[model samples]
Target: MSMRVAVVTGAARGIGLAVAQRLASVGMKVVMADLRDAAQAASMVNRDLCAGVDADVSDEASVQQLVAGVVARYGRLDVLVNNAGISPKHGGRKARVEDTALPEWQSVLDINLTGTFLMCRAALPHMRAAGWGRIVNLSSQAGRSRSAVTGAHYAASKAGILGFSRILAEEVGGDGITVNCVAPGRIATAMAAAVPETVNQEIAARIPLARLGTAAEVADAVSFLVSEQAAYLTGVTLDVNGGYFMA
Candidate 1:
């Protein structure tokens, strides 16, 4: 059997980078996609097993070109990790809904929600042809529940991902493609670091785990969902929130 090929978006750093590293470690040829610094990051992950491609997930042409380049080089694409998203803050704090500009809202939706849609659309054909695939879209605790730390646009975009994954999962299960989501909460990443330290400390006090979750922890969940062991699972939202929220 040929080596499996995986594409991980927003893989230049943080949770995305961690997931890319994990996948490459498992022997899959990984394509680390990001708007910038992706090649450098992929080199750090595994020069022999990983390649980085520049792509704007929100742009349809860019997405098509990205997947085309991957298939051209690797001959197949078996896994897609849609981890590209943005949670913008204002003056180090979440902007209230009333304060959020139209552009900001559209930007969040374009990247977080629409980007996932575009990537899946472009990759589904390859997966169907191969008769196997795994797709894991990154959601957030803000999407699962109320969040004071994130803006409304962020919450909406993340929630949209959950809905989108569920429908896609149902549609593609017959094709041997499993689509699912990983909703992380209070993860200690650069995104979370945008807030005040005291804010994070207060959040930690409320969680059962008593601390923020790590990027690797979230990556672990993603790794499982994309593995053969999880073949029977589809349309599920695996929460990696450290008991912060239960549904």
Candidate 2:
């Protein structure tokens, strides 16, 4: 089989970087997209199969450029991972809805929800033309249930993803394109590190696995979802939460 091409957003570090590396390991040419420069991260991966490109998923022009660059170099797009998001923190805690600023809420929705929509819209044409594609949207456990740690905006954006993905799956199923989501819970990333150590420990204690999940673990789940083995799967949300929030 010809090597497939994948684009991973928010890949400068943490879960996104881990996903990029995992895809590359499986022989897919990977494009690591982020707001910040990801050359260093991409270099650490197999250079021949990976390249870093700067992009802000919330911006249409930037997303277009990012995908164009990938196509210009790789000639095709087989997978897209929408992982860029923002969960604003104030002194190690999410702001209460009563105190949350409009700008903060809009910004989260833009990047977390709107960004995912833009990426899928931009990539779907390519995928449809090719007649095969895989899209994985990153959601959170907070989206499925009331969140104790995250704010309303964050939870709302994630919940929106589930609805958006299901509808898209229905629309694209006949085109050989699959749209799925992954809801992660308290994964150990830079974003998650903002939580107080005491809180982290408490969350871990409640999880059936008795620990915060690792980025690589989440990446493995993504790898499976994008693989041929998951060809029959679509419109599903696989939880990588270590049993913290079981559906």
Candidate 3:
């Protein structure tokens, strides 16, 4: 049997990169997709088991080309980790809803929400044809509850992912495809480092872990969701928030 092919978007760094490395380490042929430095990142993961592709998930054409290229090279796409997202900040602070710019709002939705839609749409047929697939969309704690650290647009896009994953899971379950979400809170990634250190410390003080979560920890949750052990699970949101939020 051929090795399973997994594509991870925004994989040049942070949680996406960690997930790619984890999947590759498990013997899957991993494709790390990002707008920049993807090839370099993939090389760092495993030169023989990983390949990188530059893609703009928000652009329909780019997404189509990305899937086509993956299919051409691997003959199948078994898993997709939609981790590409942007949380714009000003002076390391979230913009107030009333002060948020329209363009910023649109950009967040386009990348965080629409990008996931495009990647899933392009990859579903291939997955259904194979009769097996795993899709893990990255969500945020802000989406699950009120957050002072993230803007409204970021929260909306993430919350939209939860709803989208549920509906898609229902539509594709009969086809052996499982769609789920991982809502991470205050992960110690470059994205999280955008804010002041004191801000993270304050948030950590409120968490049961008393520290920020690691990217690899989040990757571990994703690894399970995409594995056979999780076959019976679908349309569920797994929280990796270190007891910061419970629902």
For 1-247, candidate 3 gives per-residue lDDT tens digits of: 7899999999999999999988988899999999999999998889999999999999999999999999999899999999999999999999999999999999999999999999999999999999999999999999999999999999999999999999999999999999999999999999999999999999999999899999999999999999999999999999999999999
**Candidate models: Cα lDDT each:** 0.96, 0.93, 0.97
TM-score, cand. 2: 0.98
Query: Runs in model 1 with CA error above 4 Å?
Result: none
Q: Residue 202's C-alpha lDDT in candidate 2? A: 95
Using all chains and alpha carbons, the TM-scores for the candidates as numbered come to 0.99, 0.98, 0.99
Best by lDDT: 3
Q: Could you report the Cα RMSD, in angstroms, for every candidate shown? A: 0.6, 0.8, 0.5
Indicate the worst ten consecutive residues by lDDT in candidate 1: 89-98
Expressed as tens digits, the lDDT of each residue in 210-229 for candidate 1 is 99999999999999999989
lDDT of 2 by residue, 52-86 (tens): 88889999999888888888887899999999998
Cα error, candidate 1, residue 213 (Å): 0.6
In angstroms, give how far residue 137 of model 1 lies from its true place: 0.4
lDDT value, residue 189 of candidate 3: 96
